[model samples]
Target: MVELAETVSDVARSEDRKEFDALVQRYHKQAYNIAYRMAGNHADAEDLTQEAFIRAFRFFGQYRRELPFDSWLYKIMSNVFIDRLRRKPKAMIRSLDQPVVTSEGEAQFDVPDNSAGPEETVLSREMDSRIQAALDTLPEAFRLTVIYADIEGMSYEEIAESTSTNIGTVRSRLHRGRRLLRNKLKSYANQLV
Candidate 1:
């Protein structure tokens, strides 16, 4: 198989949309997974992934071949995710029981109850939700570090490059993040018992 760097070079030199699309096809699912973990929802994850690819396409010429393409792409995605968070205003919290007046009529938020699933499935989902909630409580820097290292299984060097930080910082953040997650999960386990 042809190397991805060669494909990147082809796109960079020729501005070939086809080559870029191939690259996108190869990495889209992984990118979306990262975005979903970062954004905490499907809609925001989709938007983040789209924006990241758009930016990557716009700046393909500047990509250095010495580094891996996925790491570079991830860097761009992380920046886009962080930028979106910075720009978005804090959302106003509303009760699900409260009714909203719409053009047609009044409507209340319909929250899904996943408690009706099979016992094992419900337990698995509950654990996943608890873990995600713990991740959400982390600061962005630590959260990104944990996601890249633990969730994505990226190497320390790759994470350092992706986050534009030294390996020491990545290690520190990962350690602290994992510690926080352990504590939170332990607390949740205790509550359940």
Candidate 2:
């Protein structure tokens, strides 16, 4: 197999779509996983992943080979996710009693009950939800740090490069994020008990 750096050089030198496609094939799943964690939904994750790759291709000339390709790619992904978040409007809360207006007529929202699963499955899902909720509560920097370090298993140096921050900043954010999550999860456990 050609080394990743060589493939990147090929693409960079000639704007080779084939080499870039090969790079995408190699990193697609990892990139999507990061996107899903960042976006918190499948649809948005897919869009974010696609946008990141598109931007990466467009800006491939700016990429420095000294940095790891994955880290550089993740930096692009993070920027895209953050940019989308900034542009997104705050979510509006709607009362269940209120009827939704449609072009044809007024319509009632159908809310599904997700609590009908087996006890073990329900508990597991609830735990995952609580963890995700805790993660969501964090500031974007801390959240991304936690996700990159813990969930994606990126090293401190890699995370620093990805986030465009120093290693000390990454360490601080990870520590603070983990502390907040621990406190939040402890409270949730108490509620369950």
Candidate 3:
């Protein structure tokens, strides 16, 4: 019945356990996706979200009254992601070596296939798989921009703030990231044909 902003602000100001729990209940799943976008993996996403909440809870007292709580929470999430990135050893995206294949007509990555000849149905699945895989190749900043704008349907300004980048950077990253994805998909379009 309560709006997320009010609930979060109250909990932050008062340390209201019930209100805070409601905030968690409402935002947990959505927060997970944000973390996943930033972290680029399931395991890391979970950790990032949990860490964000822990950090946010610890400092809820300091949350400003006029600011939207989700934005504040998201700011905390950004810190968590940056910290995770700094702490972990940077590694190449793990999906590039894998062949994107699927029984369905859609796929995430387009790997060179020796399937002899795949039917339209097979190709569709492969394309879908290749698309997803190609997406995973992007850097966390670019990846979060794409997911927030395209998948979550946030505005450029919202994504820029959530990502701690300027709108120009968000636009540039989204444009460049999508181009890179399309090129990745183009590699296996022959399979679709």
Candidate 4:
């Protein structure tokens, strides 16, 4: 594993044509998952992941060697995601009548849902949607903190490092974020019972 990392590092440092491509192959899914959680949709997640990689490649020369590369990539992704949120228009204008098409020339919206219809699956999806809505209500810092620490299963130190904050701040954000979420979800819980 160390040798593989060293080889990747050497390749990246030498600015080989395949450096970014190799990175994409290794970390694209991880980046996309983070983006998906942040953006709350597949299309936006794909766009965000692509944009983040572009930015990372552009600034690759300045990347610190001391940090884990994945963490560094995630920092770039988080920054790009935040910038997009800031600059995004309050509303977008698009024709709803347009057909959605995939890269394979297939109608995107025509895909069939073949998943199991178990009672647990239905309840889980409902709960997930409600929780995601509650998460969206948080301030960006708290939201990201909660997602990184709780959903992504990152340690407190990792969350702090990823967010460029101290561990105490990470703990504070998680505590406050969870409190807010619990309060927001209380009504839904009552209904469930």
TM-score of each prediction: 0.72, 0.70, 0.65, 0.70
lDDT of 2 by residue, 69-138 (tens): 7888999988897888668664444444478899999998654443335663534554655676667667
| Weakest lDDT window of 10 consecutive positions for candidate 1 | 113-122
Model 1 lDDT at residue 179? 91
How far is each candidate from the true structure, as Cα RMSD in Å?
7.0, 7.3, 9.5, 8.7
Off by over 4 Å in 3: 1-14, 90-129, 188-193
* Candidate 2 residue 26 C-alpha distance from true site, Å: 1.7
Model 4 C-alpha lDDT per residue in residues 1-193, reported as the tens digit of each score: 9999898878776774366678789999778777766775576778889999989988876777676779888788778877885676533422223467778784523323233466536355556656766776777788888888766799998888788889999999999999998998897776544
| Candidate 3 C-alpha lDDT tens digits along 1-91 | 4698888777656655655677789888888877765665677778999998889878766767587778778778767776786688865
Q: With candidate 3 superimposed using the best TM-score fit, by how many Å does residue 189's alpha carbon deviate from the native?
A: 5.6
Order the candidates by lDDT, highest first: 1, 2, 4, 3
lDDT of 1: 0.79
After TM-score superposition, the amount by which residue 119's alpha carbon in candidate 1 deviates from its true location, in angstroms, is 16
Consecutive 10-residue window with the lowest summed lDDT within model 4: 89-98
Model 2 error, position 52 (Å): 0.6
**Clash pairs for candidate 1:** none
Residue 21 lDDT in candidate 3: 73
Between candidates 2 and 3, the one scoring higher on TM-score is: 2
